[model samples]
Every structure is written in C-alpha cells, then in structure tokens.
Target: MDVNGFQVLPSQVESVRLIFKRHPDIAVEFRAKNQHLRNACMDFLLSLIETMCQSLEDLSNEDLVEADIALTYLKDAGFKVDWLEKKLDIVKDKKEKEQSSLARLQEMEDSLLKLKQHCSDLDALVEKEHEELSDTRTPMSFDDVV
Candidate 1:
C-alpha cells in the first residue's frame, strides 16, 4: 500500500529490485545463491514487514496477519521476534487509549450540549411566565393603600 508516499503495492519483483537498490544484503544474498528463488523469498519477507509496519517507522496492528506471517518466517529463520512483538503490543495499547479518549471526549461534549439546551428551555419558560403574570397584575391606587 501507499504509506507516507512509499508505495509498496507493486509486483514482488519490483519491490525486490527496490529493496536491492536500498539494501545490499538481500541483493547479495539473492545473487549469491538461488537468485530467482531468493529474489521471491526476499520480496516475500519484505512484503510481510511492509504490511506489518505503518509508514516504515511506527508499528501498526491493523495488519496482524502480515505481522504474524513475518514473525513466523523470521522465527523459522532463527531470528528472535520478541522485540518486534513487544513493539506491536505497544502500538495496540496506544490505539486503544486513543479510542477511549475520543469516546470520553465525545460523551462530555454531548452532555454539555444537553445541559445548554435545558438551560435555554428553562430561561424561555421563565420569560413566558413573567410576561403572563405581569398582564394579570393589578396596579394599586393611593386611595386603596390609605
């Protein structure tokens, strides 16, 4: 997909070519051995990682399948995936916290609006009652007072 203008939605071959251009390890590895097969392998690993990542820096849980695949592959490759898994957990926590905060904020705003409408309605009722009472109120004369 296109994350931060870094489009990785192209063919695996193109992705491998780009990766090779940027990182020499995959290129050398692929070239040093079963070039055609290693080319696909490197592309697959990178694709899994690209799906797991968000804009190449932040971790995202939006694509857990991708993360799982990448992690499983790396584990099979004898690489430790604990650190990456922990990073994913952190990302998931952050996302949950943000969602909760937004929900709370929305509730507060709705409550405030309701209160304001109630106050306005009360004010209008008071004004109408005052107008009605004034119309029926009798003026006292000086003679009646004496």
Candidate 2:
C-alpha cells in the first residue's frame, strides 16, 4: 500500500505501532510536555500516507517522482525522530542521576541530624555527671578536729 511518499507494506503501520507500544515509556518521554509537537508529527505522517494512498490510482512517472520526494521527506523526519530519541534518553539519564543524588543528600542530612542530637544528649549527660561529682566532693570542714 502507498503511504505518504513511501510504500507501506501490510506490516509497516503495524510494525510502527508495535514498536511505539513496546517502548511506550520512551515515546512518552520523547513527547514529554509537548502534545503539540507529537500531534503535529503524527498528523503530518498520517496525512502524507493518506495522500500517497489517494495518489496510487494515478501512479504515473510524475506521481513516482512526487512519491520519491515524499519519501525523502519521510526519511528526514525519521532522522529527526532518532535525534529526539537520543535527546530523551539523555534527559532520562540526567533526571535519574539527579534523583539519586538528591536521595543521597537527604539521607546524609538525616544522619547528620541524628548524630547532632546524639552529641547533644552526651554533652548533657557529661555535664550532669560533673555536677554530681562536684556535689559529692565536699570541701573538708575547716573546723573539724583540727
């Protein structure tokens, strides 16, 4: 079947859909926060396919040339897709690293707070002991049977 400027075999659309479904998370990441771009790309591709299908009845030499042009356009779009995918992968990795670092920092903060509290408690205990020892060490009575 003709799709856009490229030929769509029976398996082509299905294959594309399957690939996207298989990597749904990646697809979502690539389309992240930009429904407009995603929608535009999908619509453009679909329309190109529809035009190709409609032109199939008039498959003359000129039509063939047009199809070649369309195919080139589609190929360029594929390159863009590849670039977007790579960028998404990098973004995901960066986010994961940031999250990991944040978690470590939070853990360190909690540990530091606990250690500070423990030190404060120890200091209070030591001060109490010193006071107790001072109380027990009564000065020798000056008037005691000298």
Candidate 3:
C-alpha cells in the first residue's frame, strides 16, 4: 500500500509490527526519554513567553514605579530570549534529521516496489513458458506410436 507517496511493503510492515510487539518495554523507554527532552524544551519556551508577557503588562501599567521596574525586567528577559533562540535552533536541526530519515525510508520503499514488480514479471514469464511447452506436445495413438 502507498503511504504519503511511499509504498509500504508487506514484509516491512510485518517486521515493524514484530519489532514493536517484541520490544514493548524498550519502546516506552525511548518514548519516555524523548518526552523528557520535549517537556524540558517546552517548559523553557513557556517560561520565556510568560516573562515577556509580564514585562509588557508592567510597561503598560499606570504606576510609574512598575513601568520603571519593567525596564530592568526587560534586561533580565534577554537571557531567556537567547536561550529560547538556541533551543529553537536545536529543534530545527532535529526536524532536518527527521526529514532526511523519511527521505531514506521512501527510497527504500521505492526499491522494494521495483523488486516486487520484477518478481511478478518473472512469474508471468514462467507461466507463459509452461503454456507454450504444453501446446507443443505431439498427439499419439497408443499402438501407432509404439
């Protein structure tokens, strides 16, 4: 079957399913590891966003002291901004790696489809040869041929 322009071989699907079934515990272990990384990145970004929002609110408040404090808060916000920018760069790199993996998987799927087509062609050729061979058999009377 085709999935998003990639042909999914029956053998590949079976192998993936077998791997998942045989390594359920390991699967969750890896997933937990990834979730931890993702959560940390998200938390960092959220904290940065919250800080920016609070700074904006403070700057807009009627109190002159709060507006003055917002200036100092803006300076403190710079570190979080830089950290978030670096984290975003890491995310971009991860996305690029994922795209490369998908492309490789698609190439392998295309190769498998070509292999299946060749096998099908070979099977048809063999069937045709068998039919032709059967057609060439000479008819014989039992006594006359003997």
**All models: lDDT?**
0.59, 0.54, 0.47
lDDT by residue for model 1 over 25-131, one digit each (tens)? 43221222344444444545666656555643354444665567666665555434465567656666666777789799999999999999999999999999999
Query: Which candidate wins on lDDT?
Result: 1
Clashing pairs in 2: 4-48, 4-49
Task: Assess every candidate by TM-score.
Answer: 0.50, 0.44, 0.40
User: Regarding TM-score, does 1 or 3 come out ahead?
Assistant: 1
Model 3 misplaced stretches (Cα beyond 4 Å): 1-44, 47-77, 81-86, 137-146
- Candidate 1 residue 98 C-alpha distance from true site, Å: 2.3
**lDDT, candidate 2, 22-108, per-residue tens:** 544323423223555444555554554444444323434454455456545544544234433343345445556666897999999
> For residues 30-137, what per-residue lDDT tens digits would candidate 3 score against the true structure?
222344443343334334434434532242224334423443343343322333344334544555666689799999999999999999999999999999888777
Candidate 1, residue 107: how far the Cα is off, in Å: 2.7
Worst 10 residues of 2 by lDDT: 24-33
The pairs that clash in candidate 1 are none
Cα RMSDs, all models: 7.7, 18.0, 23.2
- Selected candidate, larger TM-score, 2 vs 3: 2
> What lDDT score is found at residue 103 in candidate 1?
90
